[model samples]
Target: GAGVSQTPSNKVTEKGKYVELRCDPISGHTALYWYRQSLGQGPEFLIYFQGTGAADDSGLPNDRFFAVRPEGSVSTLKIQRTERGDSAVYLCASSVQGARRTEAFFGQGTRLTVV
Candidate 1:
Protein backbone atom coordinates (compact mmCIF):
# COMPACT_ATOMS: atom_id res chain seq x y z
CA GLY A 1 0.00 0.00 0.00
CA ALA A 2 1.15 3.54 -0.78
CA GLY A 3 0.01 4.74 2.63
CA VAL A 4 -1.07 3.37 5.96
CA SER A 5 -4.19 1.28 5.60
CA GLN A 6 -6.61 0.42 8.38
CA THR A 7 -9.41 -2.05 7.95
CA PRO A 8 -13.01 -1.78 9.09
CA SER A 9 -13.17 1.96 9.52
CA ASN A 10 -15.88 1.52 12.13
CA LYS A 11 -16.41 -1.21 14.63
CA VAL A 12 -19.17 -1.62 17.19
CA THR A 13 -19.16 -4.34 19.76
CA GLU A 14 -20.84 -5.10 23.05
CA LYS A 15 -19.04 -4.67 26.30
CA GLY A 16 -16.65 -7.50 27.17
CA LYS A 17 -16.26 -8.48 23.58
CA TYR A 18 -12.86 -8.79 21.91
CA VAL A 19 -11.81 -6.83 18.88
CA GLU A 20 -8.79 -6.80 16.59
CA LEU A 21 -7.86 -3.74 14.60
CA ARG A 22 -5.43 -4.06 11.73
CA CYS A 23 -2.97 -1.62 10.24
CA ASP A 24 -0.80 -1.99 7.15
CA PRO A 25 1.91 0.59 7.06
CA ILE A 26 3.58 2.07 4.05
CA SER A 27 5.99 -0.21 2.31
CA GLY A 28 9.57 -0.14 3.64
CA HIS A 29 8.81 1.92 6.71
CA THR A 30 10.73 0.58 9.69
CA ALA A 31 8.81 2.28 12.47
CA LEU A 32 5.14 1.97 13.38
CA TYR A 33 2.97 3.37 16.14
CA TRP A 34 -0.52 2.92 17.50
CA TYR A 35 -2.49 5.69 19.10
CA ARG A 36 -5.93 6.28 20.53
CA GLN A 37 -7.99 9.43 20.42
CA SER A 38 -11.01 10.10 22.55
CA LEU A 39 -13.54 12.78 21.76
CA GLY A 40 -12.02 16.27 21.85
CA GLN A 41 -8.47 15.13 22.47
CA GLY A 42 -5.26 14.63 20.57
CA PRO A 43 -4.06 11.15 19.75
CA GLU A 44 -2.49 9.45 22.72
CA PHE A 45 0.37 7.11 22.06
CA LEU A 46 -0.40 3.48 22.74
CA ILE A 47 2.60 1.65 21.41
CA TYR A 48 5.64 1.96 19.18
CA PHE A 49 7.34 -0.78 17.22
CA GLN A 50 10.78 -0.73 15.72
CA GLY A 51 11.10 -3.58 13.28
CA THR A 52 9.38 -6.68 14.66
CA GLY A 53 9.89 -5.80 18.31
CA ALA A 54 7.87 -3.38 20.36
CA ALA A 55 10.30 -0.76 21.59
CA ASP A 56 7.68 1.04 23.61
CA ASP A 57 4.34 -0.24 24.89
CA SER A 58 4.17 1.57 28.19
CA GLY A 59 1.56 3.90 26.87
CA LEU A 60 -0.98 1.11 26.59
CA PRO A 61 -3.57 1.59 29.30
CA ASN A 62 -3.66 -1.92 30.72
CA ASP A 63 -3.32 -5.62 30.21
CA ARG A 64 -6.51 -5.61 28.21
CA PHE A 65 -4.84 -3.78 25.35
CA PHE A 66 -2.07 -5.34 23.30
CA ALA A 67 -0.46 -4.79 19.94
CA VAL A 68 1.94 -6.68 17.72
CA ARG A 69 3.89 -6.17 14.55
CA PRO A 70 5.09 -9.55 13.43
CA GLU A 71 6.78 -8.75 10.11
CA GLY A 72 7.43 -5.07 10.73
CA SER A 73 5.07 -4.20 7.90
CA VAL A 74 1.69 -4.81 9.43
CA SER A 75 0.36 -4.53 12.96
CA THR A 76 -2.68 -5.59 14.93
CA LEU A 77 -4.19 -4.13 18.05
CA LYS A 78 -6.14 -6.49 20.26
CA ILE A 79 -8.54 -5.39 22.91
CA GLN A 80 -10.00 -7.78 25.44
CA ARG A 81 -12.95 -7.26 27.74
CA THR A 82 -13.88 -4.08 26.03
CA GLU A 83 -15.60 -1.34 28.00
CA ARG A 84 -17.59 1.72 27.01
CA GLY A 85 -14.77 3.89 28.22
CA ASP A 86 -12.53 2.21 25.67
CA SER A 87 -14.47 3.65 22.80
CA ALA A 88 -12.19 5.78 20.67
CA VAL A 89 -10.51 6.20 17.30
CA TYR A 90 -7.49 3.98 16.87
CA LEU A 91 -4.84 5.60 14.71
CA CYS A 92 -1.82 4.05 13.07
CA ALA A 93 1.23 5.85 11.76
CA SER A 94 4.47 4.81 10.14
CA SER A 95 7.79 6.43 9.43
CA VAL A 96 11.23 5.55 8.28
CA GLN A 97 13.76 4.80 10.99
CA GLY A 98 16.51 7.40 11.10
CA ALA A 99 18.55 9.49 13.44
CA ARG A 100 16.96 12.60 12.01
CA ARG A 101 13.27 13.27 12.40
CA THR A 102 11.19 11.66 9.71
CA GLU A 103 7.66 12.45 8.66
CA ALA A 104 4.97 9.97 9.58
CA PHE A 105 1.96 9.06 7.54
CA PHE A 106 -1.21 8.18 9.40
CA GLY A 107 -4.20 6.13 8.49
CA GLN A 108 -7.74 7.41 8.72
CA GLY A 109 -8.22 5.33 11.89
CA THR A 110 -10.70 2.76 13.10
CA ARG A 111 -13.47 4.01 15.32
CA LEU A 112 -14.32 1.46 17.97
CA THR A 113 -17.61 1.84 19.78
CA VAL A 114 -18.29 -0.25 22.84
CA VAL A 115 -21.96 -0.46 23.53
Candidate 2:
Protein backbone atom coordinates (compact mmCIF):
# COMPACT_ATOMS: atom_id res chain seq x y z
CA GLY A 1 0.00 0.00 0.00
CA ALA A 2 1.31 3.43 -0.94
CA GLY A 3 1.81 5.83 1.94
CA VAL A 4 0.97 9.49 1.96
CA SER A 5 2.92 11.69 -0.44
CA GLN A 6 3.32 15.44 -0.86
CA THR A 7 4.61 17.57 -3.72
CA PRO A 8 7.16 20.39 -3.78
CA SER A 9 9.28 19.11 -0.91
CA ASN A 10 10.43 22.72 -0.83
CA LYS A 11 8.62 25.76 -2.09
CA VAL A 12 10.01 29.28 -2.30
CA THR A 13 7.85 32.20 -3.24
CA GLU A 14 7.56 35.91 -2.75
CA LYS A 15 5.11 37.26 -0.24
CA GLY A 16 1.61 37.80 -1.63
CA LYS A 17 1.85 34.97 -4.13
CA TYR A 18 -0.47 32.01 -4.03
CA VAL A 19 0.66 28.44 -3.49
CA GLU A 20 -0.99 25.09 -3.66
CA LEU A 21 0.14 22.10 -1.63
CA ARG A 22 -0.89 18.61 -2.63
CA CYS A 23 -1.41 15.44 -0.64
CA ASP A 24 -1.96 11.84 -1.68
CA PRO A 25 -3.21 9.56 1.03
CA ILE A 26 -2.82 5.85 1.39
CA SER A 27 -5.14 3.68 -0.61
CA GLY A 28 -8.28 2.47 1.22
CA HIS A 29 -7.87 5.01 3.98
CA THR A 30 -11.03 6.93 4.56
CA ALA A 31 -9.68 9.70 6.74
CA LEU A 32 -7.32 12.44 5.61
CA TYR A 33 -6.00 15.47 7.42
CA TRP A 34 -3.95 18.58 6.78
CA TYR A 35 -1.82 20.30 9.35
CA ARG A 36 0.77 23.02 9.67
CA GLN A 37 3.83 22.70 11.84
CA SER A 38 5.72 25.77 12.86
CA LEU A 39 9.21 25.52 14.19
CA GLY A 40 9.37 23.90 17.61
CA GLN A 41 5.62 23.40 17.67
CA GLY A 42 3.36 20.44 17.24
CA PRO A 43 1.44 20.05 14.04
CA GLU A 44 -1.75 22.08 14.14
CA PHE A 45 -4.74 20.49 12.57
CA LEU A 46 -5.99 22.53 9.63
CA ILE A 47 -8.73 20.47 8.10
CA TYR A 48 -10.02 16.91 7.94
CA PHE A 49 -11.95 15.04 5.33
CA GLN A 50 -13.94 11.89 5.89
CA GLY A 51 -14.19 10.19 2.56
CA THR A 52 -14.99 13.11 0.21
CA GLY A 53 -16.45 15.74 2.52
CA ALA A 54 -14.69 18.05 4.90
CA ALA A 55 -15.57 16.57 8.27
CA ASP A 56 -13.94 19.38 10.19
CA ASP A 57 -12.41 22.64 8.99
CA SER A 58 -12.53 24.71 12.14
CA GLY A 59 -8.79 24.60 12.44
CA LEU A 60 -8.27 26.51 9.22
CA PRO A 61 -6.63 29.78 10.19
CA ASN A 62 -8.66 32.02 7.98
CA ASP A 63 -10.19 32.51 4.58
CA ARG A 64 -6.71 32.64 3.13
CA PHE A 65 -6.48 28.90 3.48
CA PHE A 66 -8.70 26.37 1.78
CA ALA A 67 -8.68 22.65 0.95
CA VAL A 68 -10.55 20.18 -1.15
CA ARG A 69 -10.95 16.41 -1.30
CA PRO A 70 -13.04 15.71 -4.35
CA GLU A 71 -12.66 11.99 -4.90
CA GLY A 72 -11.99 10.81 -1.35
CA SER A 73 -8.41 9.90 -2.10
CA VAL A 74 -6.30 12.99 -2.80
CA SER A 75 -6.48 16.40 -1.21
CA THR A 76 -5.13 19.83 -2.08
CA LEU A 77 -4.51 22.76 0.22
CA LYS A 78 -4.57 26.23 -1.25
CA ILE A 79 -3.16 29.32 0.30
CA GLN A 80 -3.87 32.77 -1.06
CA ARG A 81 -1.48 35.69 -0.63
CA THR A 82 1.37 33.83 0.94
CA GLU A 83 3.11 35.60 3.78
CA ARG A 84 6.30 35.24 5.73
CA GLY A 85 4.20 34.58 8.78
CA ASP A 86 2.71 31.65 6.94
CA SER A 87 6.07 30.03 6.34
CA ALA A 88 6.03 26.57 7.82
CA VAL A 89 5.97 22.88 7.03
CA TYR A 90 2.64 21.74 5.66
CA LEU A 91 1.90 18.15 6.61
CA CYS A 92 -0.66 15.67 5.33
CA ALA A 93 -1.84 12.64 7.21
CA SER A 94 -4.17 9.71 6.77
CA SER A 95 -5.92 7.25 9.05
CA VAL A 96 -8.21 4.29 8.71
CA GLN A 97 -11.81 5.02 9.68
CA GLY A 98 -11.88 7.07 12.85
CA ALA A 99 -9.66 9.23 14.98
CA ARG A 100 -10.32 7.11 18.02
CA ARG A 101 -6.75 6.60 19.21
CA THR A 102 -5.64 5.83 15.69
CA GLU A 103 -2.43 7.60 14.80
CA ALA A 104 -2.06 9.38 11.51
CA PHE A 105 0.77 8.67 9.13
CA PHE A 106 2.40 11.91 7.98
CA GLY A 107 4.12 12.86 4.77
CA GLN A 108 7.56 14.39 4.33
CA GLY A 109 5.73 17.68 3.98
CA THR A 110 6.25 20.78 1.89
CA ARG A 111 8.48 23.36 3.46
CA LEU A 112 7.10 26.63 2.17
CA THR A 113 9.30 29.65 2.38
CA VAL A 114 7.68 33.01 1.81
CA VAL A 115 10.42 35.50 1.13
Candidate 3:
Protein backbone atom coordinates (compact mmCIF):
# COMPACT_ATOMS: atom_id res chain seq x y z
CA GLY A 1 0.00 0.00 0.00
CA ALA A 2 1.50 3.31 -1.04
CA GLY A 3 -1.61 5.24 -1.90
CA VAL A 4 -5.18 4.06 -1.88
CA SER A 5 -5.94 2.33 1.43
CA GLN A 6 -9.23 3.00 3.05
CA THR A 7 -10.42 1.47 6.31
CA PRO A 8 -12.31 2.48 9.42
CA SER A 9 -11.67 6.20 8.98
CA ASN A 10 -15.03 6.89 10.57
CA LYS A 11 -18.16 4.82 10.59
CA VAL A 12 -21.28 4.84 12.73
CA THR A 13 -23.88 2.20 11.94
CA GLU A 14 -27.37 1.90 13.33
CA LYS A 15 -30.41 2.19 11.07
CA GLY A 16 -30.04 -1.45 10.11
CA LYS A 17 -26.39 -2.15 10.43
CA TYR A 18 -24.37 -4.10 7.89
CA VAL A 19 -21.39 -2.37 6.42
CA GLU A 20 -18.05 -3.45 5.14
CA LEU A 21 -15.97 -0.92 3.33
CA ARG A 22 -12.36 -1.51 2.56
CA CYS A 23 -9.99 -0.83 -0.26
CA ASP A 24 -6.28 -1.42 -0.51
CA PRO A 25 -4.88 -0.58 -3.86
CA ILE A 26 -1.60 0.93 -5.01
CA SER A 27 0.76 -1.99 -5.17
CA GLY A 28 -0.21 -2.50 -8.79
CA HIS A 29 -3.36 -0.55 -9.32
CA THR A 30 -5.33 -2.09 -12.25
CA ALA A 31 -8.20 0.27 -12.15
CA LEU A 32 -10.35 -0.17 -9.06
CA TYR A 33 -12.95 2.27 -7.89
CA TRP A 34 -16.01 2.87 -5.76
CA TYR A 35 -17.23 6.25 -4.91
CA ARG A 36 -20.02 7.97 -3.08
CA GLN A 37 -20.06 11.37 -1.51
CA SER A 38 -23.20 13.04 -0.34
CA LEU A 39 -22.69 16.18 1.64
CA GLY A 40 -22.26 18.37 -1.38
CA GLN A 41 -21.71 16.45 -4.62
CA GLY A 42 -19.08 14.90 -6.89
CA PRO A 43 -17.71 11.39 -6.41
CA GLU A 44 -20.61 9.05 -7.02
CA PHE A 45 -19.39 6.25 -9.18
CA LEU A 46 -20.10 3.27 -6.92
CA ILE A 47 -18.19 0.38 -8.49
CA TYR A 48 -15.69 -0.37 -11.21
CA PHE A 49 -13.15 -3.11 -10.98
CA GLN A 50 -11.18 -4.25 -14.02
CA GLY A 51 -9.00 -7.13 -13.09
CA THR A 52 -11.34 -9.28 -11.04
CA GLY A 53 -14.33 -8.47 -13.22
CA ALA A 54 -17.04 -5.91 -12.61
CA ALA A 55 -16.16 -3.61 -15.43
CA ASP A 56 -18.71 -1.06 -14.30
CA ASP A 57 -21.45 -2.35 -12.02
CA SER A 58 -23.65 0.44 -13.34
CA GLY A 59 -22.89 2.63 -10.40
CA LEU A 60 -24.47 0.36 -7.83
CA PRO A 61 -27.33 2.08 -6.04
CA ASN A 62 -29.87 -0.63 -5.51
CA ASP A 63 -30.00 -4.01 -3.84
CA ARG A 64 -28.31 -2.40 -0.87
CA PHE A 65 -25.22 -1.71 -2.92
CA PHE A 66 -22.39 -4.18 -3.30
CA ALA A 67 -18.84 -4.40 -4.62
CA VAL A 68 -15.85 -6.67 -4.68
CA ARG A 69 -12.47 -7.19 -6.26
CA PRO A 70 -11.43 -10.72 -5.43
CA GLU A 71 -7.67 -10.62 -6.13
CA GLY A 72 -7.31 -7.46 -8.13
CA SER A 73 -5.51 -5.72 -5.28
CA VAL A 74 -8.30 -5.80 -2.69
CA SER A 75 -11.66 -4.09 -2.57
CA THR A 76 -14.93 -4.54 -0.77
CA LEU A 77 -17.93 -2.36 -0.24
CA LYS A 78 -21.07 -4.02 0.96
CA ILE A 79 -23.88 -2.18 2.61
CA GLN A 80 -27.10 -4.01 3.28
CA ARG A 81 -30.07 -2.67 5.16
CA THR A 82 -28.47 0.45 6.56
CA GLU A 83 -30.40 3.58 5.69
CA ARG A 84 -30.59 7.20 6.76
CA GLY A 85 -29.89 8.02 3.18
CA ASP A 86 -26.90 5.83 3.69
CA SER A 87 -24.65 8.55 4.90
CA ALA A 88 -21.86 9.24 2.43
CA VAL A 89 -18.13 9.64 1.96
CA TYR A 90 -16.92 6.23 0.88
CA LEU A 91 -14.47 6.68 -1.90
CA CYS A 92 -11.55 4.63 -3.16
CA ALA A 93 -9.71 4.91 -6.41
CA SER A 94 -6.78 3.55 -8.34
CA SER A 95 -5.33 3.56 -11.82
CA VAL A 96 -2.62 2.15 -14.09
CA GLN A 97 -4.19 -0.71 -16.02
CA GLY A 98 -6.23 1.17 -18.63
CA ALA A 99 -5.73 4.51 -16.95
CA ARG A 100 -9.36 5.62 -17.21
CA ARG A 101 -8.01 8.92 -18.38
CA THR A 102 -5.08 8.97 -15.99
CA GLU A 103 -4.78 10.25 -12.44
CA ALA A 104 -6.48 8.13 -9.81
CA PHE A 105 -5.09 7.04 -6.44
CA PHE A 106 -7.51 8.40 -3.89
CA GLY A 107 -8.37 6.86 -0.61
CA GLN A 108 -9.23 8.95 2.36
CA GLY A 109 -12.89 8.32 2.70
CA THR A 110 -15.14 5.84 4.44
CA ARG A 111 -17.19 8.14 6.57
CA LEU A 112 -20.45 6.21 6.71
CA THR A 113 -22.76 7.39 9.43
CA VAL A 114 -26.25 6.04 9.12
CA VAL A 115 -27.58 6.63 12.56
Best by TM-score: 1
- TM-score of model 1 vs. true structure: 0.96
lDDT tens readout by residue for model 1, 60-95: 999999998888788999999999999999999999
User: lDDT of all the models against the reference?
Assistant: 0.94, 0.94, 0.87
lDDT for 57 in candidate 1 is 94
Global lDDT of model 3 = 0.87
| TM-scores of the models, in the order given | 0.96, 0.95, 0.32
Residue pairs with backbone overlap in model 1: none
Model 2 lDDT vs. the true structure? 0.94
Candidate 3 lDDT by residue in tens digits, 1-115: 5688899899999998899999898987788888899998988887888888888888888988888888888889999999999898999988887554788878998899998
* Candidate 2 clashes between residue pairs 3 or more apart in a chain or in different chains: none
The total of clashing pairs for model 3 equals 0
Could you give candidate 2's per-residue lDDT for residues 8-47 as a string of tens digits?
A: 8999999999999999998888999999999999999999
- How far is each candidate from the true structure, as Cα RMSD in Å? 1.0, 1.0, 11.5
The C-alpha local distance difference test score for the whole of candidate 1 amounts to: 0.94
A best-first ranking of the candidates according to their TM-score comes to: 1, 2, 3
